[model samples]
Every structure is written in structure tokens, then in C-alpha cells.
Target chain A: MEMLMNPSQMTKKYFTPGVMLVSLIALNGLIFLALRLIFGVGAITNLDNQHPWGIWIGIDVAAGVALAAGGFTTAALGHIMHREEYEVVIRPALLTALLGYTFVALSVAIDLGRWYSIWHPLIFWNGNSVLFEVGICVMIYVSVLYIEFLPIVTKKFIGNVRFKGMLAKLNSPVDKLLRMLDRGLDKTMFIFIIAGVVLSCLHQSSLGTLMVIAGPKMHPLWQTPILPLLFLISAICVGFPMVIMESLIASRSFKLKPEMHVLSKLGSYIGPMLGIYLAFKVIDILIREAFVYLMVLSTESVMFSIEIIFGIILPMRLFFSKVVRESPLGIFIASMLVILGVVLNRLNNFIVAYNPPYATTSYFPSIGEISVTLGFVCIEVLMYRLIVKYFPIISIPEKAGVFKTKYSIQGSK
Target chain B: MATQGRRDFLKSLSAIGISTIGVAGITPSITKASPENILSKDRMGVLVDTTVCIGCRKCEWACKNAHDMPSGSIDDYENESVFDNKRRPDYSALTVVNKYQNDKTGSPINVKVQCMHCDQPACVSACIVGAFSKKENGSVVWDESKCIGCRYCMVACPFQIPSFDYHKALEPEIRKCDFCFDRTAEGKLPACIEICPVEAITYGRREDLVQVAQEKIKNYPERYNNHILGETEVGGTSWMYMAGVDFKNLDFPTLGDKSAPGVSESIQHGIFSYFVPPVALYALLGGVMWISKNRDKKEEN
Candidate 1:
């Protein structure tokens, strides 16, 4: 597979854009450093005591993690369901997941009041905090992801017979041990899969639970005990659509074959999840008797309606249509809308709808905050590109061995 | 060989089943016991008689002075020109007195806003790093050292009382009224209670505070509203309020008896109490794996 993708051709297509993206990322980082050194968070962020979290927590961390749920969801569908068709899309989903989690971690670091004490969670265990659960789960999951990607790393680096022989001798026992480990991982992968699903459920809901505790401070439109359920379902709803969007974008950007069948099948899962989410959302408002507030058509209500229509209803309609689902551009646009809806939902919950009676201040993200966030995203994409370029993430066909045999004979001649 | 495989499968199945049942049984009891045993005792609290308060910012000023917080100008409080506007507790100001204009009565009612010091405070429950805790004497105290500065407490607080010093580079503690826990511990009233020229703030045991609030309501029927604001709101707040007007006029959140902390904690503990769901999921996966493995074996043959 590596030999087939002529290096010169790959470089000509990818090198310039990759360099430009990296330069933009560096420029963002430089601006962030200036903000950190001179102005402090007060100068650069819209955060106040009343709105301590703002976009960093809402959009970057919470919504970002929810979008990244594609990784586990796709992995589970592919491996657990034995859908070999999904195998082609799994690595890209994993890459997105890795980058999304990385961005979340970065957002957390930026949002912390005492940024230096970030390692306190690992050092001291706070058993009661929902945040403690989030921290531990995210940290462990990040490590688990890297381990999951280790096969790609190893396949990229070790090549020569002498080196391979040395590694083989050293790793033969370890390879057997790893294969045994892989068997154990395969057998118990369901536990981790279920745990990941459950943990994501807990934390995503806890994100809403975090605001539910705000009680009256949280806008009535966003507050409910059922918030956790809404968040969990919404995260799952956004997850597959994000996978579709990411796959389409990455494939086009990398000039790789599009996995349309897998994405279309994923759309089937997404369509129903969005329906269930909207039903619960409407039912929740009705139960809370908050529909009266929507009738007034306030700025908040209009925003809420826009979020629902564009985010859920529009994309959902597109997903159900077979013609649209088959189109790469249509799926990409729907995926973007789903992401937009998730982002807006989180923003409304965390910032827009939080009504601290005494403090009526509205927040807008500072340029520095935006820069840091964008820098993290750029770094994430760069790492994904590098990994995919070097590693055999996309599995080659068994028949490719025949091509390799023929190519070797031609090279000798 | 078939019998042996069946026996092994059954043994695996039973192991999974028994462990799941055991986990399900143990989880609820564990969750119930943990929070119950950790319940704070001798919680110190305040009883505020809104009938007595003159909308004076003395308590607000005294709180800042006692805590060594940055002082807002005295004119900021006294000038009626600025007083009509509602004030919120912020990083600098741990307490605020706001006027609630009642349309029915055609009178302006004053309510001093501060931490409710809920018996089961959501801020305490929400703090995964244990930055916030209910003191035995009833104040919801914050430890800056334990704080990861996540400000989940700010988001968790029902009263919107907890304020984060987001501007500070280091040691940004959540600023809120502690019911003058440090002063109260030394056998003195909180600074707010001490300096209230109108004697609006009363500090005592939570039980006594509720009793005082109820007595005031009972004794002065015309002077006070029928309800004590915190007696049952959010599972009984430590701070009770006796207001001249309805509490809702003052923007007090209409809360139910169940504490927010209890609701979230119950769900957290309920879903994650034991390894039941994971084990069950694993068994289901294992069963699928087994069938697939056998099918592959047959295909090879």
C-alpha cells in the first residue's frame, strides 16, 4: 500500500497545505503566549465569576468530546458487530477521537484557574466529584487510545532483517504475550466498550448535571434533571454525524477513497438518535411547562428554535433521504449542521441561558481564547496527518500481497 | 467433549450472572450509606428577617472587610441613585442586597443575597476534587488548595453565590459568604450579623435559626410573609429567610424538596455502583465471539 502511493505524488498533493496549516497553528500559539504573559485571562477571555467556563468548557471541551464519540461508537460497531465494511473507516474515526480528546485536554488546561496544578487529579483522588470521574476516564482513555494505535506505530518504524530479527528475538516472547494480550483485549473489549459508553454517558450527562445544579441560575429552558439524558442522547446523535463529516473531509483532504457505504449506514443510526433526542427535548420542555417561554419569541427562544431546526430537523431530514445520504457533499453538510447543533446546545446550556439574576453580563470569546483553541485543533490535525502518512492505519487487501510479489520480481529484473 | 464445552460455558455464564447480581445488590446499599454517614453535624447558619432589613449594605461592607476583600466605595452602597439596580454576588463582592419591586403591593422589598449553605449543597457534591465541603457547623467552606479551579462549583451552586476570580493567575478561591465560619468558630457572630444596624441578620444553630424564623412569622402575621424561604427548599438550607413580600418577588429560585446534589449523586452512584453492566455486556459479546469462533472452525473444516 505504501509502495503503491508514489511518494512524489503524495508530497506534491499534501505538502503545501500541511505546511500552511502548521504555520497558522504556530501564529495562533504565538498570540496565545502574548495573551498569557501580558494580559492574563481577564484581558483575553469573556469569563467572569458568573460565567467562569464560557466557550472553553462549553464548545471546546464538552461539545468537542461529544463529537469525538464517533471513535468508540464506530469501533464498537465495526469490531463488536463484525462489520468488516466499517473497518475502512475505523482508523479515521480513531484519529478524530484522538484529536478531539487532545483538544479537550488542551481546553481544560487553558480553562483552569490554577493551570499549574493540573496534575492534582492524578496525584490526589477526589472520589466524589463528577469531574474526578471525567478526569480519570479521559486520562485513562487517552492512554488506551495510544495503546490501540500502537500496532500502527510499530508497523511504520521497524523494517530491516537484522533489526527485525533482533526485534523478533526480543519480541517473539513479547509478541506471543501481546497476542495473548490482544486475545484478552478482544474477549474483554466489550467491557471497555461498555465502560466507554457508560463513562461517556455519565460525563456527558454530568456536563448537563453540572449546570442542573446551578438551579435558577441556569435558564429554565436548559435546566432539568433530565438534562443528563438529553446530553447523553445528543452526544450520541452528534457522534456518527461527526464521523461522517470527518471521514469525508479527511478523505478529500488526503485524496483517499471515500467510504460512502459505511457513512450511509451510520446515517441510519444517526437519523433515529436525532429523532429520539428531539422528542425527549420537546417532552422535557412540555413537562417543565417551559413552552410558554418559547411563545414569547425572545432572543433565547429564537436561538433555541434555530438550533433544533438546523441541528436536528434539517440534517435528520437529509439523513433519511437515500439520495442525499449517498452524496458525499450532502452528508458533509448534514454532519456540519449536527456539529453546529451540538455546539449551540452546549453554548446555550453553559453560557447563554445561565441567568445569574445579579449579573446580567454577556460573554464573547477573546481573540486569545480563540487562538489557543484553534492552535490545539491545528496540532491535532497535524498529528493525524503524520500518523496516517507513516503508519498502515488503513488495512490493505489480502490480494495486495500478490501485487507486492509481482513488483519485487519486476524490480529484480 | 460436547458435555465438557457445555459445562465450561455454563460455569462462565454462572460466574457472570452471580457477579452481576452481587454487584446490583451491593451498589444501592453502598451509595445510601456513604452520603448518610458523611452528613455534617452542628452546622452554623443565619436567620435573616427581611422585615427588619432597611436595604442597607452594612452586611455587604462588613463581609468584605472581614474577609479582607477589595472594598467598593461607600458611595456605591448609600447612593439611592445606584441602589435601584439589582446587584449580583461577584468575585470581589461575596454578598449583595437587592431590591425586589412588587407590582401587587406597589412597594420595593429588600433581600440580602448570599450562599444558602444548603444541607446537601450541590456545590459540595459537584466538586470532584473536594474543593467545597459542608462544615460540621453548616457553612459551605472552600479550600483553595484542593481546588483544581475547575469552577464546577460556580456552575453547581443554586444561588449563584460561588464566584471564581478568573482574572487571577494563582490562588483563585471561590468567593462566597461562609456564614463567617472563622468568626463563628471563635464564639462570635459573623461580621454581617455583628454590623447589621437594623439587627436583620441572626446567627445561631441551623435548628434555632429555623425556629427563630418560624417564631417571627408566627408573632408578626401582618409584618412577615407566611413562609420561611429555606425551611424545605432544596432539602432545607441552613440559612432561613423571613421576608415582608413573597420570596419569588426577590428572584429566589423556586426549588423542590429534593436537593440537586442528591439527584446527581444518586444517578452517579446508581449507574456506576458496581461492575454489573460491563460484565453483562461482556458476556453478550463473549457469546457472540464464541459463536463466530465456532463458525470459523466449521468453515475451516
Candidate 2:
């Protein structure tokens, strides 16, 4: 990145071959989604009475919420903790969170048998339910993300409003609304930032509480009373790595120089964060004497082993090393590993550990299920790319010919 | 409600639509339709004596017929071929009878499977919309109007009894033996209990049923297992069993005495206890942000 910088929308071509491929995958997924909506969830997915929640819940909703922790984590460091060096990553993180939650909401609606009644939770809330907690928090946090992203929208169109013919007269009022929104948000942004972090903590842990009710239905290895605490810690640990992973991927995709200084500084905290989570996880297993279950070589044990070895310990060791933290590629790999670890942990918890009695066959996501999940991911990437092309989300490129942030001139950190 | 015709279904739908809009006045903490699940000493229960059952499967036919479900004929139930493979209570059949080959007698020990109607039902605690309610009669009933069909109830049931209608594109139901809430409300015995030819199923007040079960076990020591299934399983269920052999061998999911939703709900209540934790965290974060900004401003000056 250039020594002097400000966030500017990219001028590069948007429709590359990679994006075209992604669109094709998105199209495939939408086709299956149509089938699901018309013919019911059973028609498109392998979900049965034996296993009600497939990878759509496991990957799209649970893992989606975990991976999108970047928004709040970065917000805490940059705004709450007043770490100005991390400010550049905040906009992009907020966008990722906004878009990530939209996918989660879409997945939940798709996963539910009655998509029309999805809004029922808002009025028909059951405080006793862990899922109710997850649903309400995710709903509010998505709105918070949208509110958090409003500044970028306002910034882009504040004075740049241009429309043809009669619509041109309304552009000034629209710009006035944006300016008013921008000013109001500036005063109230702190509340949303704090609320975002608090909401994240509540729902992230409540997600783990979701399976605690399953109790004996889940395997002994994953079933613990401290499941919520473990979930909270892992979510906190995964937050920075997710931000680093997203930042690196966005930079590489846009053909811009990565922000090594900020990312490496972010990378330095990963070791200790992951170390704390690992310690708690180990202590939980010891307290429960769950190692006995692991002694037997089963799908549950192997998946647990892979999640710990490849996800936590390996990345922790890497992040602890100076060589890995300083290089863009090395930090990127370590962050990706951590991200994958959290994703795998969520899948293992939701899919593998949930063992209902009288199940003659185990659950495996069908091709259509996989296609829809993959399609959601593809669409997310396409949105991220398009948003960065127009919005001032990525502030890493050289500031030579790019437009200046005029309204935020005096507000610069 | 499960087998209601199109007109009845539409009427129910309209009722639900109005109630949903009516919910606007009600606080989310206490929805209007959310029943107060008060336990009673006189709550009804059933005790199955497996040793007495002849495996006639008349109970299965009666259950479906009472629920307005299609069962070809009472003759079809006596085919005796369903015992070839173990079955669960699914959408089509709300109750099923399974025969376990027992060496104690030449005849197989037949066990009936359906919702336990737990004293502390996990489905009641886990339903996202509070759709399930445990009545004073000990029947755990679900409202079709309220259920979103997320199947979280199916996941939470320790006995794995609640089954969903996956095939229906619209208004799919979570089917389970509702302990014959309708029949019991009319002061009539459950259809299965009424139809039992051999008096295999004994229905009465739950406490009376427990005493009856204990008397049966004590009177014929060799004919029954000392333990009564569901007597203490998951904090006790409305339906219980007395078998000659161990229940684990009878294909019942072995469960502890603790309720299924106990840990999860405690954790939930602990975290949100008067919302103090979230509020304090908010204040703490605001304080840190204020101090950090002030320190930066001082340094700039």
C-alpha cells in the first residue's frame, strides 16, 4: 500500500473470468433454491426426520455467523480500543458482515419449511429457546451492520449525485438525506459499535447453547455445559483471523498491494487468542473425561483431531513465529487455516456430533445442498467485488489519481 | 388438526393469521396463545405392561383411526408382518408397536412407541414460537398455527418421537402422539387405551398409575423388571412401561433422570439474567472508548 492513502473505489474491470465462473455457480444454486421453495426442503436436500438440520444450518448459518465475526472484532480494536492503525480495515469488515448476514438470513429462510413465517419469531418470541436468542440477535446485528455500512453509502453519493432528466431534481434531496444520515450516524456510531460487539458475544455463545439442549443426542465429546463458553472463546479467537483472511483475499483479488503492517500487527494477536481457546477446550475435555470417547477411532474423533491439529495448534504456532507474521503470504495461510478450523469446528458440532437415536444412516449433504451452499459463497464473493468497485471499502491502493474523500477531510483520523 | 380438510384448514389458517396480528398487543415475553404449563397431581398418565400385551396391534389401528388418519382396516393391522422390521411413530402413524424377541417367553415382548409427554417436555422448551404446551392432563400438544416447522423440536426430543412431514410443500406438520388431548378433554379414555383387548395399557391419574405400576411389579416379581421405564427418565414422562426384561434391550433410548432442557435453559437464563451482563459490557466498552479518545486528544495537544 502507498505511504499516504485514503479509501477509493476501484476503476478496474469487474467482469473477469473468475467472476464469470462464480456467476455460473450462483445461477446453479438459484435453480436448486427455486426447487426448494416450490417442492419443499425435502425435494432438494438430504435432510430427513433423522437429521433435520443439514449443512445449510451447519455451514451457511453457524459457520457464516462465526466467520463474519470480523466486523465486530475490528470495530472493537479500531473504534472502541482506539487503535487508529486498524481503521482502514473497518469498512471492508463491516461490508463483509453485512453481506455475510444476508446470506445467513437467506439460508435460514431456505432451510425453514415455512419461509413466509420467518418473521414469526419477531412477534412470537420464545425467550426459553436458545434458537430464539440466535435468531433475534442475528436479526438485530444484521440491521446494525446495515446501519454501520450506511456511512460508506452516504460518502459515495453525498456530492456525487448525478441523474438524467426529471429524476435530477430529486437527487439533491436524496443527497440531503444521505448527509443528514451521515451526521446522525457519526454521533450515534459508538452505540452501534458497542452493541455490535455485545450482540455478537450473546448470539455466538447462544449458538453453542443450541446444541446443549440436545444433550445425550449429541456425542459425549462435544456435549458439555461449558459449550457456550467454548463457543464464545472460539468466536473471539476466530474474529481477528477472519479479518486478516478477508483483507488479504480482497487485496489479492483486486490486484492491490496487501496491508502487511496492519495485518501483521493483527496477526501477532492470533497466537495468544487461539492459545486461550485451546486451553479452555482441553480443560473442558479433561473435566468431562471425554478423552475416552476420542480413544476410539470414529468419525467424531477424527474430525475433532483434525479441527484441533490443523486449525488451532498449527495456526497458533505459525502466528507466533516472526517469519509468518511479517510476510503477506505466510500470514494469509495461517489466517486461512484458522478460518477453516472454525468452519470445520462448526460443521463437526452441528453435523457430526448430533447423533439421534434410531438413525439407520448418517447424514451427508446432497449435491443440491452442496451446490446451494457453494452458490451462496459465490454470490457473496461477487457482491464483495462489486461493492469494492464502487464503494470506498478498500483503502490500500496508492493515492495518485484516485478521488479524495472531500466531506470526511476534516474528520480524517 | 393434522387431517383437517381444506375448508377446516383454511379456517384454522385464518384464525392463525388473526392471532398473529393480534400478537401485536401482547408482549413477546408472554404471547397470548402461549399456555401456562402448570403441572397437576391429577394429571393423567398411562402405564404399559409389556408382559400382558399379546402383540395384537389393535392399539396401533385405534390410534390412527382416532386421529382421523387413514388406516386401511383393523384387519390390516393384524397382518403380524409389521413386526418383521422395527418401526417408529411417523407422520402416517402416530403410534407404533415393536416386538422384541425375548427368551423369557416364547412370545415376543411387544413395546408401544409414542411421545412420552414429558413432565418437562423438551419440545415445549425448544419450540421457537412456543407452539408446544404441556396441559394439566399431561398431554404435550402442539399448535399447527404457531409451528414454523424448523424441526428444532425433533432435534430436542430425547426419545426422538416428534416426526415432521417433509413431503408437504406447504403447512407441513410435526406429528406425534399428543397423548389424545382431544379424547382426554372429553372425559373419554385414549383410543389405544380403550381399544386394548388384553388390558395392556392402564390409564389413570399419574400418581395412581405409578402406584398401580408398583403394585403390579411387587405382586409378580418374576414377570416385571424392577425398574419402570419413563418413571424417572428425563424427569419422568406421562407414559411409562413395566417390562419383564431390561428396557435397554427393548430398543428404548437410555436416558438420565435430568431434564433435557435443564442445562441449556439455565445457561440461557444465566447469560440474560435481567440483561445486566450485556448492559454492563456496553457501559464498559463505552468507557474504554471515551478514555482512549481522551488520551489520544491529550497527546495531540
Which residue pairs clash within candidate 1? Answer: A129-B128, B42-B137, B43-B137, B43-B138, B44-B137
lDDT tens readout by residue for model 2, B1-301? 1122335434543453455345433544463333334888888899999999888989889998899999887888878888999899999999999989998777789998889899988998899988898898889999888888889998899999899888788888899998888988888889999999999999999999899999988999988889998898999999999999999999888899998888888898788765657666766776686677667657757
Task: Score every model by TM-score.
Answer: 0.84, 0.93
Off by more than 4 A, model 1: A1-14, A17-22, A37-39, A123-128, A159-198, A286-289, A395-413, B1-42, B54-56, B70-85, B98-110, B285-301
Best by TM-score: 2
DockQ of each: 0.37, 0.33
Over the stretch A1-413, how does candidate 1's per-residue lDDT look in tens digits?
22221111122244666668686886786578567645556667877766677777878888888888887777666545545456556666776787788778878876777777788887555455667767877887776665555444433333422336547676456555555554444333344443454455556666666666577677778778888789888988888888888777666776666778678888888888899999999999999998888889777888888888999999889888888888888888888999899989988887788776546767778777777777777777776666666654543323243222110001111
- Model 1 chain A scores worst on lDDT over the 10 consecutive residues at A404-413
True contacts kept of 1: 0.47
Name the weakest run of 10 consecutive residues (lDDT summed) in model 2 chain B. Answer: B1-10
lDDT of 1 by residue, B30-96 (tens): 3332333555656667888877788878778889988998767765778666466777777788888
Residue A41 Cα positional deviation in candidate 2, in Å, after optimal superposition: 1.0
